[model samples]
Target: MASTLNTQLHSISFAAFILQEIMGNPREDETPQSRLKQVGMMSVLYIMHQGHQPLTISNLVEITKLTRMGVSEVIEPLIARGMLTETFVKNSMGRGKARQFAISEEIFEKLQSFQMR
Candidate 1:
């Protein structure tokens, strides 16, 4: 129906608006390095926000379709900048270690305030 088409159009428009805001608007606190890292880290966080659990480098590689090295390159800086946090745990098999990555409260708050314009 016309109403359904209208609703679908509105949804697409809103998605485009959010993408534009994310790509175009930089917060005053964001540095050039942070901005670059944000592109990758935000993709990671958006995945987590969508109910994915136990976020790890491996999971990020799978979700983002990037190589492990590529994901690590993105994650290391985010960790250093305190925009993301990592926790280590013993593997279930007790044969190795695993790391879980999550967005920091500060970054989450700042991201929440980004205008959707």
Candidate 2:
């Protein structure tokens, strides 16, 4: 299974693997065209950022070069699936809190297995 995932992940982008293998189908309103765009953005984020650190939406935007809305679109579904976890980070300077995102332990373990292939 891990080898298969590795091959598939290399053949398609990692985001496609995550979307199809883990998250299931795209939303009803989403088209293949739109999903492709999001997949590209997701690939950028996954490739460019190491998951060891939790990242903010701004961090994801910077890493993926997507707008806030675009990042939200990609992230929300993962969060909904329990594949990603989000935490609130309060600003010491009295600014509003920021949400930080990280892969869930179960998903992270699965991803690590794929990487080991």
Candidate 3:
């Protein structure tokens, strides 16, 4: 979870966003699967922004009730896009650390200020 005390899941309408100025207007060049992937990525971002705990892959899987592979697919592109970041959190026992994720601060700032076109 990454949405803290004041964090809330902000609504992002994929259909509306795609129809707007993103990528300089709707692309006739893009594929349906690509668009779907965009939607999935946005959804994961929304969840990341709204959570209060360190978001782990397992957490995403549990939250989405999706298989690990499915969640991994959604997260990979976001990471590549620089929309998400991962950090290691050490265990209480000082053993191996776990990877936790959150929206990249830069991306989160942009998302916070974004306006629909």
- Clashing residue pairs in all predictions, respectively, total 0, 0, 6
Angstrom error of the Cα, residue 10, model 3: value is 6.0
Rank order (by TM-score, best first): 2, 3, 1
Q: Candidate 1: which stretches are off by over 4 Å?
A: 1-37, 109-117
Off by over 4 Å in 2: 1-16, 22-24, 27-29, 48-53, 92-94, 111-117
Output the better candidate (1/2) by lDDT.
2
Q: Please state the error at residue 101 of candidate 2 in Å.
A: 0.4
Worst 10 residues of 2 by lDDT: 45-54
**Which 10-residue span in candidate 1 carries the lowest summed lDDT?**
108-117
Return the TM-score for candidate 2, rounded to 2 decimals: 0.59
Task: Please write out the lDDT profile of model 2 over residues 16-117, one tens digit for every residue.
Answer: 566674435766766676666555645554554444544678777776677999789877766765656889997444688988776567755766677667
* Model 1 lDDT on a 0 to 1 scale: 0.64
Clashes of 2: 0
Which lDDT tens digits does candidate 1 get at residues 1-117?
Answer: 987886555445444543454457766666666556656566556557547576787777778898988778777765765656899977657789988777677654544454233
In model 3, where do residues sit more than 4 Å from their true spots?
1-31, 91-94, 112-117
| Top lDDT hit | 2
